[model samples]
Target chain A: MIVQTALLIGLVLFSVLAILLRDLLKSAISLAAASLFLGIIFFRMNAPYAGVFEISVVAGLITVLFILTIALTKAGDEVRESRVVNWVFPLFFIAFIIIDALVMKGLLRKIPALASGAETGTFGDVLWKGRTFDLVGQIAVILAGVFAVLALFRKGDKHD
Target chain B: MIILFVALPLVVAGILPLVGKVSRRVVPDLLANAALLFLLVYAAITGRHLIAGGPVLQQLSWFGEPVAIRLALDGFSLLMLLAIALVGLAACLFSIDYMEHYGAKANYYALFLVMIAGMNGLVLATDLFNVYLFMEVAAVASYALVAFGLGRDELEAAFKYLLLSVVATAFILISVAVIFGMTGSLDFAAVAKALQELNAGAAVGVASAFFLMGFGLKAALIPFHAWLPDAHPSAPAPISAVLSGLLIKVSGVYAMTRIFLNVFGLTPALSTVLMSLGALSMVVAAFLALGQKDMKRMLAYSSISQVGYVVLGIGIGTPLGIAGGLFHLFNHALAKGLLFLTSGSVQQATGTRDLDEMGGLAKRMPITAATNLVGALSIAGVPPLNGFWSKLIIIIALVQSGHPVFAVIAVLTSVLTLWYYLLMQRKAFFGKLNEKWAAVKEAPFWMTAATVFLALLCVGIGILFSSTVTTWIQPAADVLADGVHAVIGSWGF
Candidate 1:
């Protein structure tokens, strides 16, 4: 429990640093680390399937996409100058976070008890029997995403 | 029938490019438009289904599990599907000429069909994971469509949209996973049942927060609206029509409404949050629009403002208010679709989207100019136009709900909407004819035809508001007013 709490704290700290850091590449990497930590937490909480997906899709695939964007746009080396507004945002964000944390503490304490022994059935059992339409909908989403990415990269030769 | 709505588009999207390769023109266009038209007719014929009486278990097992992908078309789903199909059919018709300038017609049509498929699937979906999936599908297509030009502006805009959209999707996915964890179910009805029986506490709150942010970004509500102006204007015109007209509404507003009203059960706090967001977008977007010099960019900002109205109406959380919101949604789609297509025509003719550079286009392109005027007036809430009736309904609904202040602000914003749209009209169509545009003729036959058709529909729907309300708007509104109780009772779980 102590180790897990320490890891969660580390994850939160890393996420903050990722957003705050100047270097885009480093920020992207830090976000990946944060996602990895989040996946660990998910697994620790007994959501093994979700944890696996969190790591593979969010930590792995999305981080790569962000890195690609940084590379494609040549934005990695761009310096983000510190400004009064930037300073204000962090201060405000921190205040909001503190308030949210206070409100969430009690709620977080009860989650484990709520989720414990919840996964008696296969993932498919709940996903298919209960939510089959959603699965098909998700497939459509993936197809749309794939098409959008391809459309973006296609050559712009005028056909007219 | 429900499955067909999703499957037809998916199958055609797959084969569209190959058909283009063979016929290279007519076949691809015909097939795509025909498919959507068929779906539109299908949805109209089926009407609303009572969950108890309808065939609910239309599944075919996959991988030795009874986990076949299913689609259940309820009133809410049917209403959204109808909008998509109607707008999609018109857009496809317009694209015949509009997309002639853009190369790879087959690929373009393929993406278009896929987006329609994704949206149709999204509306029909009953599962939480599938919603996320279809949302991404639509988002991905829109990102590409936004960047279709491959110009510097298009690429930059697409990238910005892509970044924000990915973040939104991630947030939504995390929330869905949380819900799955909590309820141990991925179905909408099942999750609702679980939530009602359990004291969801913080998890529900957290999940709801994530959904609001994720879908909020998709909706392009105030703070999350940074990408919309850039993305909407950067896309090819028909795409702009789709992006502003249907894409944002389906992927953002419709999704948010479904999840909140049906899945999560709208709470007072959530209602407040929605209303505030709506009010912010309504006011802020209008102010920003007044400052734009580019015609399409201004329209983009106006789209954001119009979306605010829909959100505001829904936020009221009254039966009449919800109906008003849905009515506004239908009107906005038609009017905005017409406006974008006309702007496309103008751009195509004069090689510019800048309001400052255009003047007295009414002489050269009478049809396009007239259509633009009708669209402008309609969107501005001029009486006898569709926009006016919807705005009137929303305002009345607001007053009936005891939010006279919001109603007043809504009226003020309507004036502002008229101001900007008239400004666009004056600069682009009414002043002295720009001598440089002497060579500009009416848009090519097909483009002129499509714009005229849409413009006429806008006027017709407005003039015949009572009839339209009776047939389409009221049924759609009824679904929302029915709310969670309707969903729960109908499902008979």
Candidate 2:
């Protein structure tokens, strides 16, 4: 329980720091850190698959993308300070969360219970049976990416 | 099978690069044209079947349980597919010669086919998750197509489109996640049933708002129209035609109307909101279009304006209104596609896209001039053109529905459309010869052929408006007019 609480607090702290950081590169790193903490929290809650995706995709791949963009653009630190969080807003947010949690607890009692094994499905079955068209969509997206990169990096007359 | 509508293009897209390398001209062009022709013929047969009151559902299953992906053949999806196939065919024809200037014809055709597959999937999808996924597919292809030239302007426009589209997708995914959390299902029928049981509280309201905003961005409605003027004009002409003529309708207007009318029965509040958005896009984009010096940019803005008429018509929630909106959808596709192709021809010959630099091109490029005149008159709502009947229907529907103020605004916007199009004509094709383009020949035969085909459609559909409406549009509108419960019943889920 104590470790779970620490992970939760780390998630909140890194998320805020990510937004508050002036340098975009540092902000990206902070965001990755927050994603890592969230992944730990998910694993603690028995969702290993979700945790794995969060760590690999959000924390790993996305951080590399952000770093590449920063390097290519040669961007400097943002001049303006972030005003995303303030004292009154946090207090109101905390109060709203409390009320929402209580209301959700009441609502949960009214919902039907899950059937046996209803919450689980094999990955292949879930993707093939549940999202056939999405697979087609993913194929299109990957092909588009391939062609887009080819078009962008083609060797030819540099005429604009 | 409905799957063939999506699969044919994809399979061809997968094989195009290999074939293009061998014979860039013959192999790729023939295969692309053949694929599109097959899809068009298939769409026609299925649309006729649906029009004659045929079967509405086509299910594909794997092992034991039925798959979540369902493809529906309703009147509405049939009409949309027909529009997509027709526009895609015309654009493909135009691109045969137009894409030669930019090498790698194979890559271009490959991406184009993928985009068509994505749109076809989007229209036929029966689940919310598939809708979002197909929307992403279409969006991704379009971003690349917009930047295909790799020029400075093209890259900038593509990046802007990409950033905004990502934001829109995020919003849509959030809404989808919320609905899935509440309902434990992704299929449209299942979600509707669950929401019905749950009494559809604040969560549904929030999701609906997100849907409107997200789809609104894709539609390039007034508030989220920043990327269109840049991106549409920056892409090659055929891509511009496809993007303005078909993509927005499939990914934005069609998705929004289907979800609102079929999934979450339309309330007065949602109807009013839709109408207001339509009105705002109509007036604002018209004014913005009026001052544009670039030819394609003006047409892009005009698309947002025409889409307004459609949204306004559907928002009225009457049968006449919905039919009028749908009719406008078909007519606008032909007229706008024709105009963009004509602009491409002029640009190809004159080496410029600025309207200010063009003059009296009729003497040099008669085919382009004549076809462009037809397209311009059609879009400007001349009495003999298709745009006239659709606008008249929408305006009359507005008046009949007791929204006289919107009717007046619609009329004023029509006049504004006419004024700008006439200005474009006078500047580009009617005045004294520019002398620089005196030796410019008419666009190549295929380009002229494509433009002329769509031009004839603009006039033909106008003259045959009644038959066209009865045969094509009314059945689609009937699907929307039936409301949510009837739609769910018809799905037989």
Candidate 3:
């Protein structure tokens, strides 16, 4: 319980820092650290597949992508963000914590511990048989992302 | 196969860019339009027959073995599928001419098809997790489409939209996680049954709140509406049409209504929340719309106001209310789609979206002006137009349900709606010819044809409202009227 609590706190802290930080590189690294903490938590919870994916894709692969993109591009003129987000976020965060402290414990306790169903299978089985539709959705998302990149970065023609 | 609704578009989208290199215009246009036409025919002609017996479930067997690719189509989903295909075909047709100035027609068509496939998949999905997944699929496609023009304003709008949308999806993911932990299943039928057995009200309430906030952002309800006015007007015209007319309805309203009414069973509190949000958006957005100089921006605000009416009727939780809400949803989709396409025509011809700068465009582009009038009148609830019937039904439903105050609000909002629409019409289309637009010409064949088609439907459906309601709206409303039993009983595999 102690270790899990510490991991979760680390996750939340890094995530908060990620949003608050103004520097893109620092923000990206903070996000990576948050993902690392989350990946560890997933591992401790006995979800090896989720843990592996979280660590590899989000923490490792995505972080590298973010950093590489940052390296490739030069910073433009400094852009000032809205002042509203500064206070609003922290206010909402503190209020959510209060609600969590007051209500979530009891609320969570009342929920029944349902037995695991199709998830109690091998990773291949789970991916292919238990959740085939998700694969189709993932494919669509990737296709959209790729096409978006192509369309956004295409040679300026008549649009010129 | 019901999978065709999703798979056909995806397959076509996958090959479109490759096909584009061989023949940029003709081949890609024909292919994309053909794909959408096929889906439209399938949904309009064959869908009702398939579901005549009951909800039909598709469990595919690949290589003679069963897979977990489960999809279901009932009255509710079929209605949404038909709407997507019809509006998708219209917008795609509009794009053929309108997008000629913008390059990469093939890639644009591909992303559009992907977005359609995502919405179809979302409606057909029978599980909570799939809902989130497909929602993201559609969302990713839209973010790109919004920024496809790659201008500074377009890029900024897309970025803001993307940021807010990520927050929305995060809330949804957390809610889904909580629900899965509570019920040990993501399937709609299983979760509905489990939730009933558990009766864990507070946890369920938390999940419901998250889902409400998330879908509310997608729908651009009152408090969460900051991103929409910018995003809708920034995109290319066909995209603007699809975004306002169809995307928000599918991702925001359809998803929320299905989850709340069917899987979770709408409580009195939830119903009240829905109604309050609806009324607030109705009054507020209409007022905001009255002040806009930008034509598409005004239409965008009006989209929010009309969506409010749909939600208000649905929130009444009566069968008549559901039917009214749905009929209005369909009406708004057609009318708004036409209005946006015509606005695109005006924009393309005049090189501006500011209503103040436009005048007597009727002389140059009579077809566009006339179609714009039909659409504006229809949406403003003028007589013998489809929007009138739907709005009247909603107002009547509110009064019948003893919500006289809300009924009055609905009526007043309709009047306010009429005022702004007339303002838009007069400023842009009715006045004496402005010398600036003296050289403007009618929109190309495809763009005019698409707008004409939707205008005719608005008039036709208005005249034939009763039969249309009996055939399409009743079945969908019946499903929601069944509430939790709709899924817990009939949807079980």
Candidate 1 per-residue lDDT over residues B192-273, each given as its tens digit: 8778888866788888999999998998998889989999998999889888989899989999998899878888898889
Task: Give lDDT tens digits, candidate 3, residues B80-147.
Answer: 99889888899999999999989999999999999999999999999999999999999999999999
Off by over 4 Å in 2: A1-28, A41-47, A61-118, A157-160, B62-68
> How well is each residue in B440-466 modelled by candidate 2, as lDDT tens digits?
999998898899889988989889889
CA-lDDT, candidates in order: 0.82, 0.86, 0.93
Give the residue spans of candidate 3 off by over 4 A. Answer: A74-100, A114-119
Per-residue lDDT of A1-160 in model 1, one digit per residue for the tens?
7878667766876687687776788889989999999999989978898899999998999999999998898744557645743685568657866876786686666553434364557887867575566555566556666666656666655764
Chain B TM-score list for all models: 0.96, 0.98, 0.99
Query: What's the count of clashing pairs in each model shown?
Result: 5, 0, 0
TM-score of each: 0.87, 0.90, 0.96
Worst 10 residues of 3 chain B by lDDT: B194-203
Clashing residue pairs for model 3: none
- lDDT score for residue B359 of model 2: 92
